[model samples]
Target: MTPSEYEHEPIRGLPGDLPPGERILWQGGPEWRTFARSALHTRWVGLYFAAMAVLALLSGSMGGLLAAAASAAAVTGLLSLFAVLVARTTVYTITNRRVVLRVGVALQKCINLPLAVIGSAELRPLTGGHGDIVLVPNAVHRLGYAMLWPHARPLKIGRPQPMLRALPDAVNVAEVLARACGAIAPIAREDAPAIRPAALPAQGVAA
Candidate 1:
């Protein structure tokens, strides 16, 4: 039988039914190819192996060259497969009231970030209108980098920022999110290289 891990979700990518007034603004999953290239660093990995293979060839050892080539192919294949699995299992939901992420391969979990708790959003535009949206929660909420791997902003271990990675037509999605947040609260616009992000009011942490 075909596997159905999310069959139990009352609404796709959500842990439970939305409150009466809440409604989804947008819903999507990562574009797997883009996800592999960005999150898995597939291109970089392939280039490294290619460089090694070239160096091995220059050393005048056919065996070494073949070994390097094989290693590169094997590693790239594995990373690509891993990316596919992650992309397949992940779903991102943008509701009028919150952002929800359903992610994980072996073990799955849902992360809900209320609009009121989000401090700011940053858009990192990629080729072909695909991009990443990084969400920084306010002081009231704390999130772990490890727990949100591949879905967390890279090199942000100090303060993890939840990310919606490899989204197709990211600009449109960002606009949807901005509008949703803006409807509930005042939003400050921030300029980005490509699309702008909506910066919401910061919520204070309890003492």
Candidate 2:
């Protein structure tokens, strides 16, 4: 869908009993990278089968080789299916008041942290040809399980915070959180708090 369509949809929930100044700033899904399968694994699988195909062609091993190829294809197909299933099992949700992550298809696992408890939010880029977001916790809490393939910012909710991975447009996600929590812009390191502009010193009093 287009960005306009996205903008039209109101931020997903009702305004609760929060103070009047509080507002629902933004809501979004994890980044597109979260949906990608490991390129290394997929490439290796393809190479192995390509070699098998070439060997079969050269040796004229028609019947037996064809059967072997079929078996290999079936196995590869199953692997692809499993990868999709895993991707679908992961989900991330961010709200003005809290962040929620859920994973697992058969048995659901969930982690939730309130924004009030968040001490800081950090964004870590996934290097080494992988693009993912890692969020660290700044305060102590049980919602410390890291989320792999997340589509949101790397946030520090409570101590031992869980890392979130695989979000799309992570930088924008981070900005939304910074504004919502009244935090300064995110920095390279997790420990540094966001810096806000200090008030100017009082001007000399007029006589």
- How large is the C-alpha RMSD of every model relative to the true structure? 6.5, 10.7
- lDDT, candidate 2, at 202: 17
Task: Please write out the lDDT profile of model 2 over residues 1-207, one tens digit for every residue.
Answer: 112222232333222233454444553333333333432145467678778877887888786578667866876777666556545555555555566555544444556655555555555433342334334445565553243222333343333444445455555556555554443214223443321112111121111
Q: Write candidate 1's Cα lDDT for 103-162 as tens digits.
A: 988788888888766767887788788989888776555678888998999998988889
Q: What is the C-alpha lDDT of each candidate?
A: 0.79, 0.47
Estimate the overall C-alpha local distance difference test score of candidate 2. 0.47
Each model's TM-score, in the order given? Answer: 0.87, 0.49
Compared with the true structure, the alpha-carbon lDDT of candidate 1 equals 0.79
- Model 1 ranges off by over 4 Å: 1-7, 186-207
